[model samples]
Target: MSQNSPTAPFSAAARPELTADPQRRLGVLLSHGFTGSPASMRPWAEYLAERGYGVEVPLLPGHGTSWQEMNTTGWADWHGAVEAAFTRLRADHDVVVVAGLSMGGALALRLAADHPDDVAAVVLVNPGINSTNKQLLALPVLKWLMPSMPAIGNDIKKPGGDEHGYERTPLKALASMLGGWRQVRADLAKVKAPVQVFRSVDDHVLDPSSVELITRHVPNASVTLLHDSFHVATIDNDAPRIYADSAEFIRSATGV
Candidate 1:
């Protein structure tokens, strides 16, 4: 079934309704990266769901569609998607942990910081906090000057992955991402959840400094640097590593 957009949520009304069973192991909310779909988090979601944890991987606004749609939307819509999923999970589970990829990591961090009492824990993969990548940071103004700019470097998994990207990313959207990260970083002290961050030592898109910032800012944080993969570690060669780490973190935090 095709997923819903930001404003149009999938009709949970049609599926057999899930009972609010408090005895279930735990609930995990998976957030995908910017310009990505639930596809990015589906593997992690499936793993958690199969292991008796209720999991939700909602598609963010202006994503999983044509790039033009994403260009029109802002980061707030993406955060809204995360907030909506978290609220739903809270209704049925006593504990909720979040796992996010790239930009989604930023959203997860922001949510944890904002609702410290509600979020039990978080697992971040290649979280893009301080994007010092010169090529990406200069895209906004550069795009305006040259409307048909060449595509950014191929940053996805090597063998196969989503290739549908914005031919010309809206400069405003790029700016909004950086701005959101700044805000998320500022509120790191408010985040009480124990965070486990996975960094790709060979990541081409984000610098090591971003991971360092994440580890330093969060009050309680742990870092693991993976050597083999790039930015999309969730689907790359080291995906199993991410899966194992996330599951372990959930178990540790919720005592499940």
Candidate 2:
């Protein structure tokens, strides 16, 4: 990972040990949370690749850089990169799954909703969609008044865990992200594929509403609670559980 520089992107292709058959190929597109770089998702991507699945961890446009730059961008920008990566994988593999960490999970759901027949399955780790913070309700006006807020990165329970993410959360970008959430929430029923979520029971970042919302709205959605991690469970103590179980879920869901 070269120390997983917050400035870089990450990607890997399928290296199937048995054959070159496209029909046997499986692909996954992973997205990191807002203000986070590919560093947060690299380990999972690499693990999936080693398991013979094509993986892509794209650095969202406004991420891997200063928060000031992020304030200039929003949800559409990030989701565009994800959709493009999914498109590329779809062209090469017959079955494709989308997985995400935090806000990335929202993007994954968006993909599954937008392409019901294409996305084979979905895996989310400590996803965030709705928040109880009243401040977000005022984003239409607050975004103009406040440029940023406290950062929401590195919320891992494991010692020495680092996501190499931004130190500030952009208000305008956040507002746009909330808008994205609305879009996905409204289209939740469009997702027809199997959905699996690894939720951190003791997460300090995202509340339980997200999992509740998913299981309630998205049919075929299920949850696996993480007892030993925080919001960034993808890189925390329960990360191995997420990786191994997610791989198994993919295999079972796709009949691979």
Candidate 3:
């Protein structure tokens, strides 16, 4: 089942974004956070593609258009999108590394957990497997009464950084995602791939509990704290560090 990946050591400066060595079937699948579109993960995706790793960043269902539209969708829709993308990438590439941000982190974990042997590696940025928001416990009833509330996007510490996510939080969709986390928590121990987590010290969106749970359950997982970034660390001050480390992880994990 093992396959060969990129062999040349990863050097972002040496390889331009336009050129990808097609000699090896190495690939990466990047999923954006909730309420966000592919634009949120564009920079990272482009960097990976340019570095000669096949990259695919899919737009989740009911996102980018409006929060109201997202309210109509649920966890099943979003997860299904990423799952399909993974399947497609797997067919084209010999090995695929699954990565995501925020809710996308949970989605990626779900893939790694379910298809432990299939996923070559896992990369998560502020993954949310659990939450401290007690209000979410009441989602069973609240989702039907209200459609949405205030937004949770654009939590970047950088002045000009933007995730390009929704303006409002969709209640129905939020409840569905929260429910999905329960399954991820139970299956965390099932993840067999090497996991890398990039956590922001001052993230205003996600609680630290999810990171704690991830490190507690998953083996061969390492955490890197991001001091100058917030929840959206992919585009924050530590963006370069993420890119460099991610390339390094792929090189180390697959022995490419």
User: Which pairs clash in model 1?
Assistant: none
10 residues in a row with least lDDT, candidate 2: 15-24
Q: Residue 25 CA error for candidate 1 (Å)?
A: 4.5
Give a tens-digit lDDT track for model 3, residues 229-248. Answer: 99999999999999989888
lDDT of 3 at 124: 97
Ranking by TM-score: 2, 3, 1
lDDT of 1 by residue, 38-71 (tens): 6666666667666667788777787666566676
On the 0 to 100 scale, the lDDT of residue 227 in model 2 is: 97
Task: Supply every candidate's count of residue pairs whose N, Cα or C atoms clash at under 3 angstroms.
Answer: 0, 0, 2
**C-alpha lDDT values of all predictions:** 0.74, 0.88, 0.84
Q: Which pairs clash (backbone N, Cα, C closer than 3 Å) in model 2?
A: none
Query: Looking at candidate 3, what is the lDDT of residue 123?
Result: 95
The numbered model that scores best in TM-score is: 2
Write one digit per residue (lDDT tens) for candidate 2, span 1-256.
3535654777787876622343588888999998887878888888888888888888889787789999999888989999999999999988899999889999999999999999999999988788877767788998999898898678989999999888888999999999999898888899999999999989887889988999999879999999999988888999898999998899889876
